[model samples]
Target: MHRTLLLLVVGVSLAFGVDWFLGEFIEEYVVRIINLCGIAIILAVSLNVINGLCGQFSLGHAGFMAIGAYVSAYFTTTLRVLNTETGETVVRAPLFDGAWGFVPALLIGGMAAAAAGLVVGVPTLRLKGDYLAIATLGFGEIVIIMLTNFESVGAARGLPGLPNYASSFWILTFAWICVVSSVFLQRSTFGRALVAIRENELAAEVMGIRVARLKVMAFIYGAFFAGLAGGLLGHLLRTISPSTFGFMKSIEVVVMLVLGGLGSLTGAIVGAIVLTVLPEALRDVEQQAKLPGIRMVVYALVLILLMIFRPQGIFGQRELSLKLLRRLLPGGRK
Candidate 1:
């Protein structure tokens, strides 16, 4: 079903998009929304490692992504993404054809984000409980404020001219990378260690698990994907504003976790996709005027109801596997 749905989506997108591109109507805007969904998946699932599996509440996701985006954008631009004081436009590279030039920029941007995960993780991972959350939140704020204050990088004005490279293809590809990497980690011994820590750091510590070290590793990896997502976001809009990676942005990522049920990577992906599509569907169909933020309000209400009723989430920790089928379908489960 997953494969079928994905193929159908791609086929429709290509058919409609090609027709639009060649027609007088210009292009289908839905492609951008699909790309946005792909990035959201990365942000939601990657954060699930520490926030969900490890039972750590983190809201600093946008900060890490911003770090990656700024660094990557800084280097990719002709100006080298250097912090600007005089307010400069981030010059875009001329596209070679239609896609390749912009595509490579995103890859380089993702690598830059991975590097930031390691750098920022080293120091901040030491704190625990509220202290850790505060520290991460502070880091995010610091990133946003720094970008806002740095006049050379355009300060609050934001930088523009980035190559819009985040197409449906790239978004889907990287989203898959995030999905596979996170799922593999969860099933591995190291992943289980994260679970151990999540359950009780004191117990994990007594058992000789390097709790602090694992937390840092998870944070860094999470930051890496967040950054990659930011890169995709920047390219999608062709602009980089300091406010783009704000605390509220981080909260949205958390919402995906909450809606999908904490600790389930698959849940996070589902939540992200559902939310992404909901907005588009709502905008297209809704006739009555509503608050611009109504979507989030609805999301919040749904989350509240989920926590009250099915607190374990859509599947909880029980992953989707063929093993479950054996008991229900006799030979079919196998």
Candidate 2:
């Protein structure tokens, strides 16, 4: 316990130090990229719980993200007050200026997304493989379409003028929390059961594991964090539209998981960082070469090369830790 507390302290200190240093020294564009990386990290890690750890193919991550973003934005942008004497209601601007209000708004968004996950997971988890993927894809489309038609959350126009409340420090803190929670869960009994189900569902069932229940739990868990990421993204961008969390957004998150390594937490983080930076890094090259879609072409080439060379992904279910780092270092632990 003491060691754990000490590690936590050190981790927080390092996080804060990095956050401050980057804000102080880095250019605005570079800092924005870093903040986006943090958000991507949260999304990738959260999706890993379902697609990587649970061996489920879900494509509706963006739908949940949309739910979170809209719900959180609503709380932060729209405020309602009731008069005690006149029994009249007044609507005011959103109030998420402080951490106390911001935290609850984010949590409510996450909870709402988790509830949606529960509703979706209970009925659809029975499907497997491509069928499951199609189902989830449909769900994502349905969400976007609904939001597009719904006028309450700013139909096709999108909600704007939101308060920019998501700082690099807050984003990193939440991302770290997601990472630690995912890592610990992967080391727990529930995680083992998930792995077993991934390997062989029938055998897992024969072993007395509640397959359906576990699947639902995994979905809920992943959706909760995805929602959290969405909330962070909404506040960071200070504007959100239904189109922002579309099929392509879900594909982006999946690419991070695949590029990293399924079932590997460290791989997800690394993949998120690399992929998030890749386009920005290529911007100069693209402009200089006068090439449209050059960035994507290069990105595709890299993915193709990776597939040819390391099909199991960069990590292949392995994690990066102090012990592993030591073993890889020259003249270090073997």
Candidate 3:
């Protein structure tokens, strides 16, 4: 326990130190991509709890993310007043003001998404595989459509001028918390029960596991984190539209999960990092090759090759650890 605590302290210190360095020296464009990567990691790992560990396929992450983004953004941007002398817009929030408001706004957004998850999950989680995926996909579309038409939240136009409260420090902190919590959840009895349900639902039920309840809980859990990621994204981007959380966004998250390796937290992190960085890295190649849409082609080819050569993904069901590293080394397996 002492060692674990020491490691945690070291990890946190290192993360904060990195965040400070990035803020002080790194360019905004690079920092933005890093922030997006952190958000992707949160989304991927959270979805892993449902799709990977629980063996349920869901595709409505965008819906939950939208809920969190809009709710939190709205909460923080409730009242806006014009400064007569300076002609600057001043924000006055009912609950809290300025940067401090982000804390409660994010929580409120997460809770709202969790509530939506419960409403959707209880009935839908009973369905299996493609059926569940379709249901969740439909739910995500419904959310986008509703937001697109809802005028209060700016409808299709989106909300703009949001305060940029999602610094690298906060983003990294939340990302770390989500990763650690997921690891613990994976080792718990609840996680085991979910795994059983994933492997064989009927057998798990016969063994006295409440499969339906667990499935719904897992869905809610995933939605909550997705919401948190959404909040961070909104703050980082300082603008959000209904179209931002469309069907493609959810598909992107799923692709990251699949690419990383199902049922592995480390895989989720790796997948998120790779996918987030890959597109930007490909931009130069596309520009030099005089191909505007080459990145999409590259993405397709990568997935195809991955499916053919390593269907289980880069990590499969395993994780990256000192033991695994040692075993993978030459002449180290004994």
Candidate 4:
């Protein structure tokens, strides 16, 4: 425990230190990309808990994230004033002023999303594989449709004028927490049960595992962090609408999980970073070559090649470690 606390403290320090450096030396665009990577890590890692570790097929991540983003944005918006360019402003007393308010807002957002997860998970989790996927996909679509028509939260226009509170420090802190928690979960008895269920649900039930309850718990857990990531994303973007949380958003996250290697946390992190950065790199090429759709073509080709060469994934249910690195190096393996 002492060692864990020490490592956490060090990590926090590092995050703050990096934030300071970025603020001082980096371009705003680069910093935004960095922050996006952090958010992607959170999303990918949280989804990995459900799809990878728990062996559940869920397509409702976008909906869960929307819940978190909207809920937290509501609170944060209530706390701040929106100044118009014409010098007309609506002022209201702060709910919980400054950065401290973001904590409660995000927590409430995550809890709301977890509750939604429970509602969806209880019945939907009974079905397996494609059935569960279809059910969750419907739920996600319903969420987007409802949000689109909800005028109180901006409806089709979406919410705007959000404060920028999702800094590198906060984003990285939450991401680190999510990753550490998942690692612990994967090592626990409950995690073993999940693995068993993944192998064979009938056999897992026969072994006395509470399959239903565990599946719901995993769903809720994943939803909570998805909410947190959503909150961070909304704050960073400073605007959000139903379109932002569409089915495609969920598919993108699943793609990250697949590209990284299902069931591998390290791979999730890697996939998130690579996917988040790859587009920007391609954008430069698209601009230089004056190709309108070349970026998309290249992206598709890369994914197709990866699927052909490494069907499982780049990591293929494995992780990066000192031993793995040595094995990959020439003349280093026995």
Candidate 5:
């Protein structure tokens, strides 16, 4: 416990210190990229819980993210004013501003996403393999269509003017929290049960594991963090559109998980960072060479090469740790 607390303190200090001191020195675009990396880390890790650990194929992650983004933005921007004389609630400016409203709004957003996960998971999780994948894909498309038609959230016009409260420090803090929680969960008995089901559902059930309940739990847990990531992203950009959380967005997260090595937390983090930065790096190169769409061509080539050379992904279900680091270091034990 003491060690954990110490690590937490150190992590918090480092995050804040970087945000306060190093942020000023960095270019705004670089800072934005870093923040996006953090959000991607959260999304990838959370999806790892369901897809990696539980062996579930879900493509509706973006839908949950959309729910969180729109809900949180609504809470932060819309205010209800009560009038005693008319006994009516009037719409006014947002009730919460800055940091004061950001935290609660995020929580509400997470809860809302979790609820949506429950609603979807209860019935859909019973399906296995490609059927599950198709179901989730349908769900994601449905969500995007619903949002596009929902005028309250500005519909296709999108929601704008969200408070810019998602600082680098906050993004890092929440991402770290997600990392710790996911690691802890993976180490617990519940995590073991999920793994068992992932390996063989019938055998797991015979061994007394409640596959349905556990799967639902995994869905809810994963959805919650995805929502949190969405809220952070919405606030960071200060604007959001339904189109932003479309099928391609879900594919992006899946690519990170696959590229990182499914079921490996460290891989998820590394993959998120690498993939998030790769496009930007390529974009720079493209501009210099005056080549349009070159970044995507290179990105596709990299994925193909990776699949051919390292089919199991960069880490292949293994995690990086102090011991592994030491083994890789010079003059250290092999």
Candidate 6:
């Protein structure tokens, strides 16, 4: 409960802060970008569970996102059910109106993704390291390909008729949920077991940790959040395409984890926010000038520098809890 309260307070406060300081910019465009950042945080932190904590290298997150996006899109798209009265459609968006429609769709999307994760993880979790990565990468590619072939989902065309409902409020709420859940999991005995497995699977097996189960659970949980993020993003954008959830998207989330520092929740959130917003900040250049892929080039430089100097990452496996600061500051604690 304390953790939940903290999450609520912090997330709400941050939302208000952004609203205040960024009121102008946000009114124009930053609002949507901030929402995207929140979703990115969800993806990064969730991926951190599978990659940073469990030491798994699965890369099929985009596939899971595509699955969830299509499922959720089906629920709230105008293209679904229509009213017979005057031939006007009874449109129900996934919360573009700040109503109750968005929440349930997002949860359902997360569940569907989680179910998919279980299916995939059950078979693939047995693999480890680079093999796991390759398998997941293939999974993502397969999902994209499958999306292209599905006629009901618009096939090669983009999925549409979605209501734009994503907002900073919803975005921050999801971010807080991801952060708090991650922190809770990390502090639990199960978290300890996961860490043990990550450190040494052979030793953890001897120590009675169900390595496969833990690994599968991590993958499922990671995919669940990934889907939730995708649903939110799709609704916000009011459209979906297989291309949106692709290998590069998965790589972007992983890069967020790496740049923020693996094994650190704070770092993951920071990395996601920075990366999510940075590209948008450069959008002006793209519109009025020629800045093709400049974001990637600058990002590559920063990554190279970070690898050379602080390969351990920004937090270096250390959490950003206030307790650490309080301890270091002598009288900083309440």
Rank candidates by TM-score, best first. Answer: 4, 5, 3, 2, 6, 1
RMSD per model, one decimal: 5.7, 3.8, 3.8, 3.5, 3.3, 4.5
lDDT per residue for candidate 3 within 9-108, as digits (tens), equals: 7767867997999989999899989999999999999999999999999999999999999899888766465566898877665455677788899989
Give the TM-score comparing model 2 with the true structure, all chains together: 0.91
Question: In angstroms, how far off is 108's CA in candidate 4?
Answer: 0.9
Cα displacement (Å) at residue 25, model 1: 14
Model 4 TM-score on a 0 to 1 scale: 0.93
**On a 0 to 100 scale, what is the lDDT of residue 48 in model 4?**
89
Model 3 lDDT-worst window of ten: 75-84
lDDT of 4 at 102: 93
- Tens-place lDDT digits, model 1, residues 1-334: 5854675566556545643553444355665666678889999999999798777677789987887676666655544344356665554454333566555556566666666666667786666678877877887898899999976566898877666555566666678777877877888888999999999999999999998788878877787788888887886777899999999898888877777778888789888888788867766444456556676566678778988998887768765555764656856633
Q: In model 5, which runs have C-alpha deviations exceeding 4 angstroms?
A: 1-8, 78-91
Query: What lDDT tens digits, residue by residue, belong to model 6 across residues 1-334?
Result: 8857877788878776765666555475656677788889999999999888988887888888888787877776756434556766554543333447777878888999999899888998668788989988998999899889876667878788677666676777788778888989999988888889889999999999999899889988998998898888898888899999989988888888988888888989888988888777767666677868776777778878988999988877888777887877867756
lDDT accuracy of residue 20 in candidate 6? 62
Q: Mind giving the per-residue lDDT tens digits that candidate 2 earns over 1-334?
A: 6855676677677678888999899998998999999999999999998999889999999999999988888888864445667878767777565656778889899999999899889999779999999899899899999999976667887888667778887788888788877877898999999999999999999999999999999999999998989999999898789999999999889888889998899999999999999999898999999997899989888888988898878888998789999999999967
lDDT of 5: 0.91
TM-score result, candidate 1: 0.79
Ranking by lDDT: 5, 3, 4, 2, 6, 1
TM-scores of the candidates in the order shown: 0.79, 0.91, 0.92, 0.93, 0.93, 0.85
* For model 6, the run of ten residues with the poorest summed lDDT: 90-99
lDDT against true structure, model 1:
0.75
Clashes by residue pair, model 4: none
